[model samples]
Target: MLVLWEIYPWRNVEVKKSVLVVLVVALTLIFPLNVFASVQIQRPVYVEGKRIAFDISPIVEKGTTLVQIRPLYEALGLTLSFDPKTREVKGGNDKYEVVLTLGSDLAKVNGKEHKLELAPRTIKGHTMVPLRFVAESVGNSVYVNTDTKRIFIGVFMTYLKDKYFDMSWGLSKEEVSKINKNDHNELLYENNKFLFYDTEFSLASKKNMVPANKIYSFEGNKLSGAIVKFNSSDDFDEQYSTYTQVIYDLNNLYRTSSIYPYDKYWIEGDSIERAYREVYKDDRMKMYEMAVRSGDLVFICPFDFADTELALFLQNKGTFSKPEYEVSIMYEQNKEFFNQISN
Candidate 1:
């Protein structure tokens, strides 16, 4: 008894601690803790940051986003019932009730008639209605990224000037030092302005987004501009394709674009092979440069500030230096910052 008591696991402080740690680990494995982070599940549509997959894919008809009524019933939290006799679908929660009729571009919401973007129709034998209208009527806002072709319902899509990930514009360096991250992994910063990257929808796994470097420019210790730079040291052709998509992604937010060519070999809408041919046309100087802009906020492809007027300005300010890259695209921002030097 004395031997067993001396060797007893709980009787020993170290042994008791080890046993507690093992038990806690086992319990944790069985029941994992939920930590807040950006939604990683990839889907065509997201409701409140949660992925919702529809049986019949949603489509845009006449510029109106249409989705199945049945699947969204539970997702959006509404008690829905279809009436075959009147060819009307009735859905309601405590806040609002909606009545939709097939082939009619009008709906009854909370006893009030509201016009819909597109009339409800049967596609693949399932009832479809305008997603934006239905969602908004139920107190959920909807946002769509044209380039990504992803729909966000009940998620606030912050303006580029307002927010990026969990970080907001006008944040001080001290405030941003503790970023919410929102499931995105942080990368090392190069210049004090560039705050590295988010690595979830990041990388080719793109299981969602292509990884890109994010630069947060600060003026007077407050965030002034947020820039995203995409580059590939891989094949030139692949780089061209990636930049094309990157530009498209920027366009989805900014809408219009203007091209600015600086280098001599610049060609508009040319192939990678052609661009490569142009860049190496003379080994004396191999330079590829141009910028595609939408107002003050936009994208710069192959932006090399080195050996340019901008380079001199940046050097004078000691804010930016040239980065070596084979091919790249930088989505830039802030009228205040650009107004200083872009002229």
Candidate 2:
């Protein structure tokens, strides 16, 4: 049995109002005396399949492991007794009584003496003991896998993040084959719009996909990213068609970045300039850098402007018909994806 004592502060609030044409209100806050609380209970251990998820949310008991002790204890048929006065525990069977201090690492089995490989400690005032030592000492097998971050007890496997997608987890050979084939569709559209800007990147493992853009990683076999083309400098109506066409493949853009070369002379304060400045502040730089470093095909949006300064900056010939402009450092040719997308 385990017992814990806790104390907490309490605050009281009171509000008073006077009845009149103009009412007066009074509020009083009071601090109450702190009280100590104690409780006694049998030890508990929670067993999940090779993985255990610890709830570290509550400040009172955060990071405390809710253990499952029955299977391990019953396997050895160990009888346990606790002395509340000295906070000591005696367990084992009639054949032996193991004496253990609540907070000490030393234990004596029938007075012969023994050592705890790891001392049992109180977390958030709850006594926690190592499951491995207790189980194995009682003839129950305990296996832990550091590689998979898993623990196995009596054919039960438990692992951290078993219910979540972990990017570092490795894939099996069959999973690798399936991923290489691009058999999943991880992209989803929100608000029925294609040019969304959130990182909801994932693939449905069950979706059928062709092999052109498949990624094989614990992340998933999805398109990691791609260069998309958006040509919209034409007539507004015709440009809309091009925009839709560019966004049609929006579902396939993975880790996408863009390239913009010198084309026409757009004004310094033009929408293109503004868009670029805004995107420069976006912290998704690493994704774009990854795309650029990969040397993937990049999409560009050539700005067509008549501003002389912009013209000189682009080094335009002061002519139309797709005049060649000079790409500036501010407009890195490797990462203009957002600008191209906006265009």
Please give the RMSD to the true structure for each candidate, in Å.
23.2, 22.7
TM-score of each prediction = 0.40, 0.25
Distance (Å) between predicted and true CA of 225, model 2?
43
lDDT of 2 by residue, 16-113 (tens): 11122322232232224522222222222223322233432111112222233333344456776667897776667656565666656676766766
Give the TM-score comparing model 1 with the true structure, all chains together: 0.40
Q: After aligning candidate 1 to the native by TM-score, how far in Å is the CA of 154 from where it should be?
A: 2.4
Q: Please give, for residues 176-278, the per-residue lDDT of candidate 1 as tens digits.
A: 6566354665756534443555443343312455555555556667664444444333233344445455434433333221233212222233464365557
Off by over 4 Å in 1: 1-43, 157-165, 168-343
Give each model's clash number. Answer: 3, 18
Candidate 1: C-alpha lDDT: 0.48
Q: What is the model-wide C-alpha lDDT for candidate 2?
A: 0.30
Model 1 lowest lDDT segment of ten: 308-317
